[model samples]
Target: MAQQVQSAIPARSGGNHPKGLPYLFLTEMWERFGYYLMLGIFVLYMKETQGEGGMGFPAVTAYDIFGTFIAFTYLTPFLGGFLADRKLGYINSVYLGGALMGLGYMGLALPGLGFFYASIALIIIGNGFFKPSISTLLGNLYSEEQYKDKKDAGYNIFYMGINIGAFVCNIIGAFMRNKFDWSAAFLSAGVGMFLGLIVFTIGLKHYRHANVLKPAVAGDTGIGQVLSLVFLPAIIAGVLGWMIPGDILGSDSTDAFIAATIPVIIFFVSLYYRANKDDKRPIAALLAIFAVSVMFWAVFKQNGTVLTDWAQNYTDRQVSESMEQAAGKLYLAEEVSSKESMVTQYDNQFRTLKDDNGKEVKAMGRSVYFRNIDPARIPADGKPVYLVNTELFQSVNPGWVVMLTPLVVAFFAFLRRKKKEPSTPAKIAWGMLISALSTLVMVAAVYAGHNGEFKVSALWLVGCYGVITIGELFLSPMGLSLVSKLSPPRLTALMMGGFFLSTSIGNKLSGILAKTWYNYEDKSHFFLVNCGLLLVSAAIGFVMLKWLNKIMQEKGVK
Candidate 1:
């Protein structure tokens, strides 16, 4: 591999940064466009009735699959980073990963059970390579002193592009899924991913300088040793977990997931143990941040799972008739029959109550949960309400991101000018606190709706997304910046992988939490629990502020 590939070569420079940055920016935008486009509809497709061109899985089951896929998708960056650091280099890794992911998205369009699972596996493996390599490449671009000070701003700009793709994808996904078929939407995602690959290929020359292969550090584990110690054992253990006679985690798939995570966890733990003295404190700090951040992700990711269920089944989605003609012409909205009797299906899906023997006893009249909604609030009979599709709700957070990025950037820029800015850790701490408050909107919605007895205004969802997007603007990009700033030069890419590893674990936890969605008797309590979890995480982040700021000062970042 080394002989086949050359070291990273520098790209041409312009005013303040490399000319390649724009190309890289566009590439990431399209890549996220594809990924989020598919993800926005993944769970909805799984849980929708078969008549609607979906798999019609149970809600909890769909949440589990959603969580697992997202978890493993983040996990692979570790392997990708390790290989890129040692052998393959960043550019090749990105190409290989993008191709696999594109193929995976295409495979999902195939109408066969065999292709379905296989497609998920391909996406998981492919994401491992693609995710970390690109971030590492971006970090390399800013390594020069001239660009170093602007690194956070550049990442914020890049992050905005990511959200732009995310914001627009839901409209495309909704249009494709509603107007054509689920398969068409899936295929569109594949096409978008492939387009990103094409853009990356065209821009390759601009980023070649950042793809250098580093010599292994002293005491660095050999490739052969890592394979034996990590990959081989992990596979064996996972298979064993799957094949074991007794159920350990309710399903073989769950057992396998838990088992598979073991070796990966061990490897990260070993990173701390093996660190040099200078690197130890920083590594410890990163690990601490990673662990605390999981709760935030667990709650935040529910936008696609439990929250999606609420939007589809409980929220008022009736469109106004005055705009129906134009909406229909543009193929931007869906028209479900409001007069259609949804009682039987809704009860069947939600499972309202239990009998004396603990068997499910389904109820009548739209599960009583939606019984209090005024008929006037629903669409007029036989007239199609050209309402925005449910999947479009996924765009809310990203939409807020696009609207708020400039303000957030300006806010921090103001702080920088006055030298009154909080450290990145402090920003992250405030983010969690603010994010926790966002859940209160949902809690209030629960009260307003009388525990789902009535339909809450869709504006509640909009308000919640707006509040949390501010917190996300504060935290998510800063986490990436923190990883880059605090990491040792050789460990930069590896620490990037570490950040994803944290995300992977948090995704799995999100799944676990969502699976229990049906068990919440009063849903307000559930959201409150979510709020409390974020508050605890925020508390932890604040408690460590002094130490984290000291480290930032030592590293000259704050």
Candidate 2:
């Protein structure tokens, strides 16, 4: 590994930064394009009626699968990062991961439950390999003395790439799905993944130097030990959780996922105890950050679940003639008839109506979206109304990121110049607080909608996403930058895995929280619960801010 590191050519400057930055930025963008495109419609595809060319699962089942899928997708990065550090080099791991993900996305185009599960499995495994290594590689590039100071900015820029993909993919997904079908949208994701790989390959020469393998130190746990102690136990635990007589945590899959994470969590904890003195405090600090940030993801990840539901059924999607005409031309408008016909019906809670004989009950007249809409707003005489596709709302958060990144970068740059910038930990604490406020926006939206009696404006969703995007800008990229700065060299990728581990838990929690969406009649109460969680997380972050800042100072990085 040392020889490998020495033999590679040193990084060349690309203007003010490493030449590798643009390549990495674009690679991550297309990768996210694939991932988010699939995610944007995942639950929608699952819950749509079979007659409508969808899987036709009930809302509860779809939410469960959505949560589990995202949870596991993040969970596997733990193992992927470990493998890259010990055996496969970073570049090889990325290629392997990308190929698997591409196959998985394409596979989703096939019909059948078997294909769905198999494709999801491939994506989960691929993300495990792909996610952490790429971020770790970027960190290594900045490890060069000349580039160290710009690490945070580089991550911010890279994060924008991710959002750019995320922002655009949904639009593409909307066009594909509207123009063709769900399968076409999914196939597009696969194509996007391959395009990402192509971009990565083109820039390989620029980042190859940074992909050198890190040799394990005396204290490091070997792959064999991790497989036996962590991976095997997690499998057994998950199986036990699944086979248990009843659902312990909303559903069998959620219970299983939560159980499986116990061993991995214990493993990360043990790292703090086993680390050399120099590494101990940094690891401890990171663990604390990971714990608090879980709350943020739990709420933020709702965009695909409950948030999507809000957009699809609760938000006012009606557009003016010119706007409708413009969107329709791009195939971004969904046309639904207002005529009385046999259509799927649901209670106020949005659960599917069922007959006593275990059959779904259909209501005559008006589509589901019309139930909460004002009578005057409904198109009369059975006319078809064109509305924005629900999935396009998924682009809002990432769209905010793209628009806001430059301003945020400039703001922080000004602070840096004035020598008044908050430490990374302080920035995170503020982020948590800011994120808490976004939930309040949704709470207001619920009130404005009169508890689903009428549709609310789409701006509520936009406002919520806009506020949270700021919080995300503060926390998400900073968390990545902090991990890069604070981690022990040999453990860089592993620590990156730890970061994703936090995200996995949070994603699962988001699912769990979404599961409770029907339980709240007030709707505002649901957003309040979300608000409470983030506030508690923010409080804890602020409480530990000083201690975390100390660790950063001791480590000699900003």
Candidate 3:
């Protein structure tokens, strides 16, 4: 394998970085394009009226499925990373994962619950394989002596690729869904995935050297032991969790996921105890970071659920008259009728109103978006109102990433030159603190909008995303870089899986939190809860900072 890898290596191109960077960058960009495009509309599609070609699920149901879907997507990467490390090599795993995801996206275009579920399953499994492999491959590319020092910068650039795809896909999704239908938008995501595969195929030669597989070391656990001790028990526990109770943690999926993760969590903790002396502290440190980071993801991942609902229903999306025509042409606006029609009646909490007989009450009403607007601001009766598309708000965080990444990079570079730069663990701690503050922005938004009695300015969402994006910049890419730096060679990708396991738990928690969206009479309290969770996470991160820093120093990594 070593000889094959060395023989396959191409001479370095006349550039500061390896020739593979652009290819990997573009590949990840398009993969995220497909993934985020589907995600941007996932819950919206579920909550839309069946007459409008959606699933017509209740808002809570939509939130549940959204949470589960995202949770599983991250969860599978653990298995995928493990498989890539042990059986399928990195490049092959990427191809397999990308292909499965593309098919899954395309399958979503078909009309049926079966197809919907099957497609989602494919995406979940596919992402498991693709996500860790590509990231590990990129890290491997930088493992070369000539490129070792640039690893952090490389991940930042790769992360920017993810945001670029994420930033643009929502615009394309909005345009497609508006111009045609949900099927068209989903098909567009599939097309984007295929395009990414093409880019990956074109650059295979450049990264072939980095695709070498690592053999298990003496202390490493065997695949059979992992399957029996971890995966099989997880499956049994999940099944029992699903069957045993009535919403132990608010929903069946949440209960099952939490239950299932127990064995996996145990397995990770055991790795520290079982690791060789040389590997013990690094493993322990990574595990600690992973545990704290779950809170960040739990809060951050709500952009697809709770935050999307806020954008759709609470944010003032009204376009100015001058821009209305342009917005419509660009498919950036959705026109809602002011005319009232017979529909299910709901209270301010968006819970369905019921009669004494337990049947839903019906009444003539405008769309939900109009429920809280000042009567004076509403258009004359029977006229159409043009508002910005809700999915477009999904682009805001990524937009901030695109706009702020360079400034962030420079800011850190300046700090580095002054010998005042924070360590990776310190940066992650600061990230949690900054992220905690962002929830306060939403708390203020709730007050500004009078608890959703009136629409708030769109700038509020932008500001919230702006603040959180800074925190994301500090933590997300740094986490990846840290894993690469600290992981034992044979275990790198598996440890990457560990990072995503934290994300998976957090993603599920996001859904669980979002499910309570309707229960909050004072929406500010909801955001305050989120703020508190992050604050606790930040406090923990800071408390552990000295120990984590010492571990990193012992490992000879920054």
Candidate 4:
């Protein structure tokens, strides 16, 4: 492979930034639009009865699948980044990955179990190729003399675009599903991905300079060697775990995933051992961050599962006429306007109704929140009311992210001016602590709700998201920037993949933790688990702060 596929980026005097930012920004926006749109409704779709064109899986089964799917989606980035660095140039990889993802989303519109599974596989594989490479390429733009100082800001802006896509997609997802069907909602996701591809292609020339492919050096491990050591062993381990008679972990799939991951973990450890003296400390620092971050992601990533459940059944969603009217304009309202009180049936929701002979019928109601509404606030027998769509709750974090990105960027900039800006390590430590604090808000909400006997105000969720968003602002962009600033040029994309790997682990754990929501009689305990996770992570982060910062300084990375 050539060392660098450098294109002459168009020069703009005093601009000091690449023209490609807008293109990348918009491309990522649409990509996230598709991804988040699909994710926002994924669990809901899984829970629907088979007669309703869903899997009709049990809650445990659904979460297990969810965990596996998300885990595999991120796992491929390591391999994808490796290939992009060694063989396929970044541009080719991006196009191929985007097309695969688009096709995967569209495939969901088709019927049958095979197609569904195949579509998911396509998406997971495609994401591996798409995610890390693009971020690595974006970081490449900052390698320019004039743009280096602006890298963090650029990443923050890029992150904001991601949230913009996430925020808007839930609106679209909620409207599309409510207006049409699951097929229509999924088709919309496919269309969004294709649009992202078009945007990426349109800006090909601008990103071309950043598509450098690094060739293997004399001492580097070859693809064949890596496959033999990592993939081969992992596959055998997973199969053995799956075939085992009893549960070694939660389930067969979880057992297999855990087994499969062991070799990969070993591979990372080996990387540290093999890395030269110059690269070892930085790699070690990143690995530490990666490990601690698993806790944060485990808690933060529950938005789709546990948090969705809270919004759907526990929270007060009833909105006033004016609020409903405005939200409807944004495609954010669910029509709970029917006056009839005939109860419906669904899994994971509850209502007590009388059967013909005075026997209790454990029915599921349309507005299950009705069960938790204050007796006085409950609509008289058949009165109509409005509620925001449950999926709209998924947008709260991303919305907060978009709103606060600028302020966060400016805050760090302010600190920089005063020569008091916290180092990246310090920022990450604080991020974890703040993340721990966010869970307390949910604990308060649980108490206020009387353990789902009454509805808690939406403000609790908003507040939690606000606090977590601050944590996200501190750690996420900084983590991305740190990888770029410190990684060996040849291994930059690989390290980016590493960060995603950590997040992947956390995401899977999030699913696992969410799986236990049904088991928690005291809802506050659920939030407490999340709080404890972040607290432990924060403690570890604080303990290593001095060491991590020293490494950054030694490596000449801020």
The CA-based lDDT of model 3 is what? Answer: 0.88
Q: What TM-score against the true fold does each predicted structure earn?
A: 0.91, 0.97, 0.95, 0.92
Tens digit per residue, CA lDDT, model 2, 1-558 = 212212221221112567787788888999999999999999999988888899988898999999999999999999999999989989999999999999999999999999999999999999999999999999999999988988888888889889999999999999999999999999999999999999899889999999878898897899999999999999999999999989978899988999999999999999999999999999999999999999999999999999999999899998887687787788998988889999888887777787897467896868888888889877677788898999999999999998888788878877888999899998898999999999999999999989888899999999999999999999999999999999999999999999999999999999999999988889999999999999999999999988999999999988
Give me candidate 4's TM-score against the actual structure: 0.92
Query: If ranked by lDDT, best first, what sequence of candidates would result?
Result: 2, 3, 4, 1
Q: Total backbone clashes of model 3? A: 0
Error of 1 at 308 (Å): 0.9
The deviation in Å at residue 29 for candidate 3 is 0.4
- How do the residues 116-157 of candidate 3 rate in per-residue lDDT, one tens digit apiece? 999999999999999999999999999888987667667777
Estimate candidate 2's alpha-carbon lDDT, on a 0 to 1 scale: 0.91
How far in Å is the alpha carbon of 134 misplaced in model 2? 0.4
Candidates' C-alpha lDDT: 0.79, 0.91, 0.88, 0.82
- Judging by lDDT against the true structure, name the best candidate: 2
Best by TM-score: 2
Please give, for residues 334-442, the per-residue lDDT of candidate 1 as tens digits.
7645444443334523633435774434333332333456866554554445556788898998899887887787777778788887888899999999999989999
Off-target runs (Cα >4 Å) in candidate 4 are 1-15, 323-331, 337-367, 375-378, 381-384
Clashing pairs in 4: 7-209
Better of 1 and 4 by TM-score: 4
